[model samples]
Target: MALHNKIGVLGEEIAVRYLKKEGYYIVERNYRNKFGEIDIIAAKESYTIFVEVKSRSSENYIELAQSLYHKQLHNIRQAAIFYFSEKNIHLSSIRFDLIALKIDPDAKKIDKLKHFTNIIN
Candidate 1:
């Protein structure tokens, strides 16, 4: 894999570890549709979460933070809708989450990580 792809894989791994530690059951990873991609999908309580993860080693965290915008949000929502319909999942609630990560590539350590929940609704 390319360096950027490696960074994303590491980041997603970190995100999954954090979520599982926090009591969320992972439902899927790298869910894609015609709309967009959801990096992680998890279930907790009655909530089904669609997560978007932004990972980078060279870029500033703030810049990575700004990378997700309205278009992407819309696409994610559309994809989530498709997922629920396709999977026949009938959850009480649906939510969107953002997991931003900045890693030390050489050390394979995360320097900073933030999880923002209910990003869409």
Candidate 2:
């Protein structure tokens, strides 16, 4: 795999761990539809969350969360809609979330992570 892909995989792993720790039940990972991809799908007490994960080795140059562009958000929304419809789920509430992971190469650990909920407008 390419270095970038490896980094991305690491970031996703970190995001999943964080979500599980936060009491979110992971329903899916890399869920895909014709519209686009949702990195993670999780559920809590009253909401189902569609998550987008951005991971980077460092945040000094650019923050990982900043990479979620408008078009990407649109795609994620479309995909989420499709997922719900196909599953025949009438959710009380649905939300979009972004999980940004900052990896520290030297320490071989995640330096930081931020979860932004209700990210879609």
Candidate 3:
């Protein structure tokens, strides 16, 4: 895998662990369709969430990560809509989430992590 892809995979794994620890039950990962790809799909309480994970080696990950997929959020949303239409899921609510991570390239550990909830709106 390329360096950025490796970073993304590692960041996504970390995001999954963080979500589980935060009481979200993982429904799926890497859900892709004609629209786009959603890095993680999870459920918590009454919400089914579509999450996008972004990773960077720099400490300025907040803006960088957020900007990286700002435009692609639409594609993720489209995929989520397609997903809901095809699945039997009946969550009371739906959400779009973002998990941004700054990883230590050498240690492969997170230097910073932020989870933005309901980001589309």
Candidate 4:
């Protein structure tokens, strides 16, 4: 696989590990719909979370929050809704999460990790 693709896969793997460690029960990964893909779906408490994982080799001055754009958020929301509709899940406590990671390319470990919950507004 391409280096970028490999990096993304590794990032998702790390995100899943982190979420599990934080007491989230993973429901799915790489869920796709006609709209787009959700990197992870997890449950914690009464909420079902849809996560978007973004990875970079370095922070490189750009803020992770600024890196996520409206188009991407739109797709994630659409996909999440599609997933819920298909599953017949109608819980009011649905959440959108963003997990950003800066991975050390040489070590294949996280240099930095940030999780933002309820990102949609």
Candidate 5:
């Protein structure tokens, strides 16, 4: 895999580990269709979550909030709809989450992880 793709995979792994630690039951990962892709799917309490993961190497400097684009958010929503329809899941509460990772280049370890929940309605 390309270095960027590898970083992404690592970031998703880290995100999943963090979510599990926070008591979220992992439902799926890399859920995708023609619409788009969801990096992770997890559940906590009454809320089912759709997660998007973004990772940056130590050499890269960018704000987490600015890293995500409007179109990416749009596609995530579309994928969430497709996931629910296909899986026949109907929940009263749904949430969108974004996990941003800062990885150390030399060790390839996650230096930090920032999780933003309920990004969209």
Candidate 6:
């Protein structure tokens, strides 16, 4: 589709790979409900993590993790609750995480990646 959309898809792929490397068992991608979407849903240890992935061409402009605004967090939380209820999952702990991916044009890989955990209430 559009260039920006392509970049976003790439960034999401990179984020999933990175999470897998970190030993997270990915449960779903682009999990959505009426409220909004959660880019990734993963499990590690005893916790279920809802992830938001942000991608940018460069980190020089802005910190990608900062892009997750309060409204977005609210939507994610709503979606997470819906997902939990629908899946019949009674998790003892849940977490929200943001994964920022900085793309490298030359290498066709992520230039930088940052993970911010427990980002929402």
- lDDT per prediction? 0.89, 0.85, 0.87, 0.88, 0.86, 0.86
Q: Tell me the lDDT of candidate 6.
A: 0.86
Candidate 4 ranges with C-alpha deviation above 4 Å = 60-62
Expressed as tens digits, the lDDT of each residue in 5-121 for candidate 2 is 888888888889999999999999999889998999999999999999887886732455668788998899899999988989885588999887778765668887888889886
Cα shift from native, residue 73, model 2 (Å):
0.5
Write the residue-wise lDDT of candidate 5 on 1-121 in tens digits.
8888889888888899999999999999999898898999999999999998888885332577677789988989988888888988785489998888998756979888888888887
Tens-digit per-residue lDDT, 55-117, candidate 3:
899757557554855568778878998898778555458999889899987899999998888
- If scored against the real structure, what TM-score would every candidate get? 0.93, 0.91, 0.91, 0.92, 0.91, 0.92
TM-score of 6: 0.92
Once all C-alphas are superposed, what RMSD does model 5 give against the true structure? 1.7
Give the lowest summed-lDDT range of ten residues in model 3.
61-70
- lDDT agreement of model 1 with the native: 0.89
Residue 74, candidate 3: alpha-carbon lDDT? 75
Q: How many backbone clashes does candidate 4 have?
A: 0
What are the per-residue Cα lDDT tens digits for candidate 4 across 1-121? 8877888999999999999999999999999889999999999999989999988886632477778799999998888888988989785588999998988867889988989889997
Task: Tally clashing residue pairs in candidate 1.
Answer: 0
Q: In candidate 1, residue 79 scores what lDDT?
A: 94
Instruction: Return the lDDT, model 4, position 100.
Output: 89
The runs of at least 3 residues in candidate 1 whose Cα sits more than 4 Å from the true structure, single-residue gaps closed, are none
- For candidate 2, the 10 contiguous residues with the lowest summed lDDT are 58-67
Q: State candidate 2's TM-score.
A: 0.91
Which of 2 and 4 is ahead in TM-score?
4
| Clash numbers, per candidate | 0, 0, 0, 0, 0, 0
